[model samples]
Target: MPVPRRLFRAPSRSLLARLAALIALLVGALLVWTLSTVYEQRKLMHRHQAERELQTIGRLQAQAVADWRTSRLADANALTDDSLFAQAVARWQSAPQTEHEATAFVQERLRILQERARYSVVSFVAPDGTVSMGNSSKTVPDAEKKALAHAIESAAPAIVEPRRAPFFAFPFFSLMAPIFDGTRPLGAVWLVMDVRTSLYPLLSPWPTASETAESVLVQAQGKDALLLTPLRRHGELETPTVVSASDTARPLVQAVAGARGLLYGRDDRNTPVIAVVNAIAESPWLLVSEIEVNEAFGEAATRELWVLSLPVSAAVLIAALLLGGWQWRARLRESALKDKLAQNMQWLESAQKAALVGYYVYERSGDTFTLSPMASELFGLTPEAPVARTQWLAQVHPADRAQVLAGLDEALRERKPLRMQYRLVDGSQERWVDMWGEHDAPSANARMTGTVQDITERQRAEEKLGQYRTALEALVRQDPMTGVANRRALTEALTVEWQRAARIQAPLSVLMIDVDHFKAFNDRYGHLAGDECLRKVAKALARTVARATDLVARYGGEEFAVLLPATGRAEAQAIAEKLRLAVRKLAIVHAASGVATVVTVSIGVATAQTKTAMRSEELGRAGAQANAERESLHLIHQADQALYAAKEGGRDAVVAQAEAPSSTALVGSGAAPDPTVSPPPPRST
Candidate 1:
């Protein structure tokens, strides 16, 4: 066929050309705006991720330091209760010449502890701050006498801040636990630990691999913030540098001044950094987890460059296509048109690759998928051939295959947008992908077009955050000493169980168990043996309570509690007796305990009657919930009173508190009680 004359006309500045130019300009501007918006959003997301990571590290380091401090204090407390060691000290002090064995025993104990606990020095200090016995010949510094006095007066374990002593080569801290003879305070057992060996290492490891990331332990010293641990930037130092508290740009100062969470500040080198601050529990210090701002946001900057380049590249391509179309208008033919279309397809593929997105079109009639090159790569398929429906399905993870298929079928049948996240499997590898699809032409051919994005990194980050959260929660709710539920966990469990029981109109029972004359036991055997005794008792109590719903918890020092859900007074009493018998069977000798030659437990049992809870329902749901909480507390109070009655009567026994008409006028059935005795006040869990 002969070419039309208009098709071969010369290029001119006509209305159509002017309109096309204007449209191109607007499209280019819109493309830049969209890319800029995406770039900004990505930067914000990067900043948020950095802050989250810093905060996680800060919390973790803070928790670690707190645990370390607790362990030190625990060691001190255990040493203080060492009756045999205390007697040895007493004999050595009274008569050093005649009591050579006592002197040798004290020296050996200190030496063994110093080696075993990795302490720099272990000493028995007298009330006047004199080192009576020590593993090393180091003398106590005059500057630390005040701390010794404080430990003796408080009669509790105390931590001395890390400092240098003439006798020690490296800076060290002291853990002092007061030694006592019954009610009178003797001296204190001093534990000297080198910070370099013990504490500084905890802050060295970063959760993610990075050279500039570090943790700093800072203490507020009046007008200055002292670095307790040396910064990684400075390598090793004989002494730490103190930053002025007035430096508002420093995260250490901000941390001491009560600022927490994310902060943008500078470090010792005055380099800008992104940091998170958290206070270490029970200590006058704060933890700063920081990284250089440049290092932290380096990837974001690269992404921004790429993000900007894409729009400019698109503009260039658009202009070239426009110019090429104008030049080739006169030579329009099937082959040339096909070549132009092929260029457009290449550009589309490049854009898809740049965005890390894969596109696919599924034809229901042929049960085949036409995939872009990126899509074929994502599915681990050959790009030269179309993929069958079965092959596509086989690539999906077995766990997520059914859901993906259902989403596809629904989108095709219902003619709606399909959006879901599922996993893809290729050999031994698994990946998470986010997908979105819609019917290309709902009224015509049943074709579904979709885009898939890899989100595996995001999934892994979320899972890691969840694990940290779980570990933190476990630390908060668990008892470090006995490996049982702490008081906080017990209280939370009680609240939840009470609410559940109230909902089902079931009975709830509580048991309060106390070791008989536990103070005397500690005084007789020393704190270490006392701790062992408590552990054995805890284990016995745990084993005796056979129900999965029953919880055995450490209520407090020398006290334990058991929560029994859906249990009546009879069953509760039986369980309490069994728990008592279990401890008796342990045959742990407790000569100090007057109840028996062996250790015994006194248990108080109280059950919340179903009738008592039924009355709470008369109030609305909110009121019922509130009343249930009050009832739970009241139940504990009754148990406490019953425990008192068990103690009043002979020690090794179980006393069940019987409910009366008034709730307050409850009496214990195990022991004779005054009819006029009123119920003890409700106690907070």
Candidate 2:
């Protein structure tokens, strides 16, 4: 400044100035790039909003269907209550044997039930499927009546069927429940509800005016389905295409094939439309909502247009006129910046080395790459030469490579964060590393910036934790030696099964299993070997029962309980026989009988769907109205009687138990008893 130095002597333009100029040029370019990036982010946000809207509709569908099914189930359960049928049958059965007496009794019942059950009519059927009594317009048509009497259900407390009625020629969901003489099916009661009107309130505000959307209920089977149209979207044509499970029209079949939740409907052409589905509880139906492109993206498209242009124009305006001198300075600055950039890059390399972690960027579009010193160390490099990702991957364990790529690809495609643990070799020795990454979609290649850390100790701890959890879970539920449920487990299972049976008209059965001569056997054999014998029997039970619904548990002492949820008596009996035979096969010594053979067990079978089923299947010690409740007394009495009967009849057999209905017995209780009922025809071994 003092001497007014010439251009050559202006301190060689100073490296700092040059670098600052280069930074300005780079910043200008970065500002343009930043505007583009912001535009993309806006577009992504709008798309995300659409996804959110669809997800909301999906939840709405699920809730609507659940509400509908719950209503129907409640109606069905109320209609099939045992008390109503018992009252009708008791009056008819107790009185004179004349047809006129029975017909008169039936006519009175039909009128009372039609008013109470909110139905057009109600009718009665004898054990032989004959309609002995009815005052209703819908009598048992000949076609259904022929199939009704020998309906193969010797113990269906209630049944549902399709029948002809005067109100609607088209068949509706109909049911038949029997009055019981102990375990016998005496007569039947039928109930029906109109599907469309009864279910209208459940599917409300559905064809959402905000979006041209409608929700439908479809029944999904293996590959075919039944459609129940509840709501219609705008512009959606009601093309009733009845495609079968075995339809040869490949496209239609595939579209409706899974017919799972959240599906779209297309015209006969199978064009694209967006749909979402949710399944109704306990019923074979699905609730689905569909949206058109216009409905789904109309607002988003408008938002995208506004979001794209404004920032870009501002960036362009800033880039013009005022930036020319900056550009000249930037060009000169770039050359000097190389050295400074080298220095900054060295800091990154040093930072990675100090941290014992590695940084990596996976570029989906380009093969170009760079590695820090720590990354080089992880990939078996000598710290003399840098390692490329492709070469580093070559050193990765083969089993892990496919998994790593899958994680990487997923991160790249959906722009989702990813994490993975895998092994890599360093100097012929394996080292485990855990990696975490953030997906960056702004990059054309959809890159990931991730960090990796050695996690060999963490993996070992995880394995130990898994084993501990399994052991703890087993301790909570299982018998130590037998690998069956303990008392606590059985109680939980009973609650779960009871709720399920109540929800669906599905049957649930229980067998109060007790080993016949266990005290004698234990007296002969030591407790250790007795424990072993139980283990053997439990093993047999585990093998013999075919269905997953069956659960075996040790009740207390030598007694065990088998919970057969969603099973009828026939199925329960089948499993019981298998279990009984399986115990005989074990051959544990019965010391009292002087035989070194396996112990035998007598099973008391009870089913919720049986005509004489008890409400308190396993009577609790206390209840809501303890003094007034006869169910508490009846169930305990019946179970004890059945146990005594099992002992009386034989050592190894099945005796089903039900309570005898007394005025003292609770009216709503499921138990119904008759003295004349006998054991079912003996099942073959």
Candidate 3:
């Protein structure tokens, strides 16, 4: 039995209608997805742009703060070097009972300094922790008086942490410089500054001018984070607004703990913000620049709204047209299919260019290479140019040519895949390319097909990574504050130099240098000035020992060690004297030093010469090499003993000691030394 023609025709009509509806739905979905993708890309680009802008502003603000602090410190340091002020201070300190004229003159000079430097108050603090002269009668607090004594002892400028003045009851920060009369402490000059007027303004008026954009300076005090500078939205200027350190979302807490870069977190007002945190170099402060997330993304949101509307309107218009022209849908579908095919081909071409990849085929028997247009362009040749194996190899860098050829040859002989990364030079530019090849078994001729991808950016990134690793290694071997070789590096160098000296039968000299009265200097000048003083001393010692073979390293705080290979006791003594004289010539005032008015160093020099031979069985073959290391340690111990003797004999002198034969003999015999061996005498220089 056959079905009726009318039944077949009805089902065909229903199927056609269903197909048209399905097509309409599919087209609308595609349109929506494309619009969403475009909107997301635009939003991401805008967000990245904003983040970059914020980072630039944050760095600039940090630099400004650093410059401001440097300038303020320079002002205080310069005052310490003023001859007129020093002379007035000297006269007043020498005869305070009879020097009424000197006191008046010093007070007048302080007034002039106060006016010139825009200080709130100016005072002269006596060495006995008393405010001897001032424009006002307000007595200095005992805490500040102690700080003054510290500054005078260190003979360096000190910046007191901001606080409320005792009598005036105003928030202020003080800068104090020690008064020195030929390295003898006379008194200190104090300049108190209003923080609101001087430092608070640095945080305002952000670069982008958004309502919520702000930059702030924060300092960590105990378990609390204090807003050292003003806040744009909350808190009083120059007043301590403390927040808990446990709040990990707080940028101040993160920054104080040494976290950096852009972060998404809530501000003090609990508003969502994108913040960039940068630490001010050499200061106990953080510069945080933030803006509300909503405000930052406002323009991107508007653009997204427009993008959404465009696809919806297009969908409605397309739906209407499809329904009205239902009769011509079959023909339209055929034409649309052709257009889609062409578009897909164009998309593939574009994808290849974007990825920097190209295809190629190599015919081994014919010695020919067939390149796609993209591959030809990658090699800087005309598109669709006929390429040969020789021509392709010619484009390869001379340095990479041999390796590439070897890989190709091995792959051909073994019938294996070939993968290589090499450089290709075109004119003055060089590009890195990763080439992969596999045997094409289907081909009648011996052939391989593969892809070549431009990997220049990746190569450059790897090179940069290598350089950063090198820099990181160097930093690990260097002291961050003093810019000298650290103890670890010094230890490694000593080991190498010790072994070399033993092999060559040369003397190895070690100098242990300790800065005189360093604790007193640090107590007086504060840690920042103390660091500066150490940096100066380290640099001076480095310059004093110009020999490339010699190593000057910061052994520890206020202590440095110099390793001199192939040097004897007399020469080491002369070098120690030169170093001592060099430090004295620096004329760095050390008011609390008992040895000299200026900064000085006590050096202990020790020299070791190879003189003893030991039985192989007694030394143990493995311990033979350890003997040199043992001797090096013994040398350092002797130097430290000499250093102690120099310090005992009054600092600012050089002491010398020679390595004892008993120490080496004991090491070879594997016997510990007795506790009752008398040490060598101090050879004063």
Best by TM-score: 1
Q: What is candidate 2's lDDT per residue for 1-685, written digit by digit as tens? A: 4755463443344565556555646754654464445446545655555555565656655664575455444444443454644555666666646546555655654554553334543665666665544354344655445435544263343333222245455435455554565555666665555544444334545433554555555554456754554344322213232447675332234435554444445633344456665555666555655666556665666665565445445444543432444346756445434544553345344434433467666666664334445765676654434345677678789889988878776766778788888998766567888788886767676666777766565456456645755554556577666888886677666665544443333455667666776656667777677778778877887777666667888765666777776566677777777788888888766766433354787777765553333354344435423422333333433443565577668668878775233333332234444334322233233
Error of 3 at 69 (Å): 33
Clashes of each: 1, 12, 1
* Model 3: how far residue 427 lies from native, Å: 3.5
Candidate 1 per-residue C-alpha lDDT over 1-685 given as tens digits, one digit per residue, 9 for 90 to 100: 9988887875564655566556556655655665565566556767777778778778877887897787677678878877877888788878989999999888866765674456877887777777744354444776557777788788787777876667677889887788877767778888999988788877886757898999988888886888888888786544547888879899888988888888899876889999988888888888888899988987776876685576468666755577457545635433444554464466556555655578888787888988878888888887747789899899999988888898888877788898999998867889888888878775656788888877777789879987877776686677667888876678778877776654454567899998988878989999899999999999898888776677898876788899988687888898899899999999999998988999999999988754323443355667666655666677887897799799889989999999523332121121232245332222222
RMSD of candidates 1 onward, in order: 11.7, 20.2, 13.5
Q: In model 2, which regions exceed 4 Å deviation? A: 1-57, 60-64, 70-87, 90-117, 125-172, 178-187, 230-256, 259-272, 313-685
lDDT of each: 0.76, 0.56, 0.75
Candidate 1: lDDT over CA atoms?
A: 0.76
TM-score for candidate 2, please give it: 0.38
Q: After superposition, how far is residue 242 of candidate 1 from its true place, in Å?
A: 2.6
Residue 215: error of model 1 in Å?
0.7
The count of residue-pair clashes in candidate 1 stands at 1
For model 3, residues 147-226, the per-residue Cα lDDT tens digits are 77778767888777665644456777787788888888877777788877767665666644588888888788876677
Name model 1 segments beyond 4 Å from true.
1-20, 37-56, 132-139, 205-208, 222-224, 237-240, 307-311, 317-349, 359-377, 380-392, 403-419, 427-429, 436-451, 457-685
